[model samples]
Target chain A: GDSVTQTEGLVTLTKGLPVMLNCTYQTTYSPFLFWYVQHLNEAPKLLLKSSTDNKRTEHQGFYATLHKSSSSFHLQKSSVQLSDSALYFCALSELGSFNKLTFGAGTRLAVCP
Target chain B: GGIITQTPKFLIGQEGQKLTLKCQQNFNHDTMYWYRQDSGKGLRLIYYSITENDLQKGDLSEGYDASREKKSSFSLTVTSAQKNEMAVFLCASSISQFSNERLFFGHGTKLSVL
Candidate 1:
């Protein structure tokens, strides 16, 4: 079984401030980590994903490195924007367990201008 | 790019009533899934299908039934709706059940139980 944890249920940051959304996962098998973002009234879309250990994968100004040793893939952005206000989800999928995907309780990020 | 379509953006049902949610995908994916999203509860898997006519129960499958009527369509049924089950139901599809493919979700169907 695989599970993901997102420490914060909500994160409020001022525009232009750097932000980090914590994410950690648990799995006995090799895992794939992903970050999905959902804007208000929209479907959730993939933001970033990686299975390579210790390597950072980035998209849309956000980046996260997969740290297998710590089982974490924290999402970070050097500068936040008002448009960045949305719900972020961390997910996990085991290598061979193809169809099994687990998502964490989302963190709602509010970027204030 | 293919799109996942979920019918009836909003669903309202009386307690104990049976409600069905429909999903269709043009991605020609080999697997489809249904997940329930609640405030602070994340996405809870309800059911999944690896191929046409196949169905697999997920962590939160109780009181639910699923049908993979065709490769492009997957439907979920709430055996008996409850107020506690009022939430959004998301339909997703992946390339195949054998690949570590990412899921593409549809605009979820928000459900309400009266």
Candidate 2:
């Protein structure tokens, strides 16, 4: 079985500040890591995904690198915007088990003025 | 560019009631899934279908049944609603279950059990 852990339940940051949402995962097989974002009243959508270890994936100012050695894929943004406030979920899928994705508890990022 | 439609944007049920949620997709995807989303609990998979007439139980499949009679449609039923149960049920579809395709999700149906 695979599992993902997001250390933060909520993160409040001022606009233009750097932010990082911690994410870690555990699995016996090769892992495909992903970040999904859900805004208020909207469904979750893919933000970034990566299967290659050590390669950083970026989307919409968010970036994450899959660190197989550390089992981490922390999401980071250099400068947060008001629109960046949302629920972030870290997910993992085994190399061949794309249909069975394991997701973290989720972290809500709140960007304030 | 396709859409996933989930019926009954909101659902209210009484204890011991059986409730069904419906989903349909126009992506012509080969896989469909149902997930339960609770505040701070993240999304938990309830059931998934790789193709027509196929269903596979997920980690949170207990107390729920699923039907995939058609490639474009999937339905989930809660055998017995619990008191004060509140969560969002999301429907999703991907091009194929075997590949690492991104899932396209519907807006989700909010459920409340009294």
Q: How many clashes does the backbone of model 1 have?
A: 0
lDDT of 2 by residue, B6-98 (tens): 998999999999999999999999999999999988899999999999999999999999999999999999999999999999999999995
The Cα error of candidate 1 at residue B106, in Å, is 0.3
Candidate 2 residues A1-113, lDDT tens each?
A: 67899999999999999999999999999888889999998989999999998998899889999999999999999999999999999988888865678889999999999
C-alpha local distance difference test of each model: 0.92, 0.94
The lowest-lDDT stretch of 10 consecutive residues in candidate 2 chain B is B95-104
Model 1 agreement with the true structure over B7-112: per-residue lDDT tens digits: 9899999999999999999999999999999999799999999999999999999999999989999999999998755799999999888535788999999999
TM-score of 1: 0.97
C-alpha lDDT of residue A39 in model 2 = 95
Docking class of 1: medium
Best model number under DockQ? 1
Each model's fnat? Answer: 0.68, 0.58
